[model samples]
Target: MAAPIDRPGARWGVAMCHGFSGSPSSVAPWAKGLAARGFDVEVPRLPGHGTDWRDLEGRRWREWTECFEEACARVAARNDVVFLAGLSMGGAIALRTASRLPVAGVAVVNPGLGFYDWRVRYIGAIRHFLRTTAPIDEPAAPEPVGDEGDYPVTPLAAVYELRQLFRATDRALPKVTAPLLAFKSDADPVVPPSSMTRILRRVASDDVEFVPLHESPHVATRDREALLIVARTAEFFERCAAKAAHPAVGA
Candidate 1:
């Protein structure tokens, strides 16, 4: 299992969360990129992730979200400005966190809020009979990059938990007021485009920006447009940090 990544020394901190069934490796590059810029960065390995899929079978969304919340609290304690970045299910966790916490900003890529396929709705009913499902697809990355460590199988129980999380996150979206930076791949196979549309429409954030990735798939962090993602993420966090430090006095 890959260990968490932490870099210290800076007034601003970023807590990055990986997607479901994905380890910290998925977002390691993005964390390092921000750390290199001198901001404290932390990439936490979610509960039951970076390990056997069976370990994820009984875990609920609350466990995953709590782990992320702990990491955010640690980062926020040390830095004047703090932000959250996540992919897929992690994005849902981040949005949920932002609704309750006073984070400076939020950045999400290929956020999996809801699925278009009707099959997922029935997972809860059939999960007791089917323990696990086959791997969805082989990890794809650019030439020099290797696959980000992900589980070989999907746990049906965990999928049900994710569905529950999506419903809760959707309900909480109207309460998230932090500046948001959302990136979506036009060809993502795992998460449908509705995920992005729903977030944009429901989130109460006044400052929101969406970037479309034409060539990447679900895991855009490790795909061809990774550098662009790093750049935009850094730029967005910097902008948020600046605003937090020097807020306007009156309307």
Candidate 2:
């Protein structure tokens, strides 16, 4: 886990999570963009990531959630308000974590709720025969998204574990009441469109905005529109923070 920027008098903090099989480097650029704008940030390297795929193969999805929870705890301890953000699988984890914690807001890109592949349902049995599956293709995003440090071959066991995480997140979606901002690349080859749709449908947040990343792929965090994500997310964070400071009149 990278130490968060500890600026004095920083009242708000953001904790970002990387996708499965990926380290914090994948989201470092986005985090740096936020930190540059005076937001204290923590991008945690999830357990069993940033090393060999075999290491990840042995880990379950719960371990990933624990790491994310721990990172959020670190930021929430110092800041009066905290926001959550993530990309890909990290986005899914962020949503689940938000349901568990009291966050001011959440911003995510390409959050995975369900996969395009139907075989994922059978991964539990299939893993006995196949040890690994082909990894995500190199995104042809016109410009480079940098090296995401993704696993060359995804372990079948990990895929199964991800499925379990998605199930748990799907069930917990209704508990996410914080203001939310979500992005989904129209051409995303990884997570299906249902991911964004399901989150919007299930979350209890009255303040929800879903942006479509036109022509972008799954790795929008580093794609050509990466800066767009950073800018819009920062704006959302500020708005949410202001709302937290003064709530609307109620009955």
The C-alpha lDDT values of all candidates are: 0.87, 0.89
lDDT by residue (tens digit), candidate 1, 82-112? 9999999989999999998999999999999
TM-score of each: 0.93, 0.94
Q: Go through the candidates in order and give the clash count of each.
A: 0, 0
* Model 1 steric clash pairs: none
Model 2 alpha-carbon miss at residue 131, Å: 0.6
Candidate maximizing lDDT: 2
Shift in Å, residue 145, candidate 2: 4.8
Q: Scored by Cα lDDT, where does model 2 land?
A: 0.89
Query: What's the C-alpha lDDT at position 185 in model 1?
Result: 93
Tens digits of per-residue lDDT for model 2, 1-251: 23334435548899999998988878877898888877889998887899999999989999999999999999999889899999999999999999999999999999999999999999999999999988977556576656778888999999999999999999999999999999999888889898898999999999999898996788888888888898899889988987987799880
**Residue ranges of candidate 1 with Cα displaced over 4 Å:** 1-10
Q: Residue 23 CA error for candidate 1 (Å)?
A: 0.3
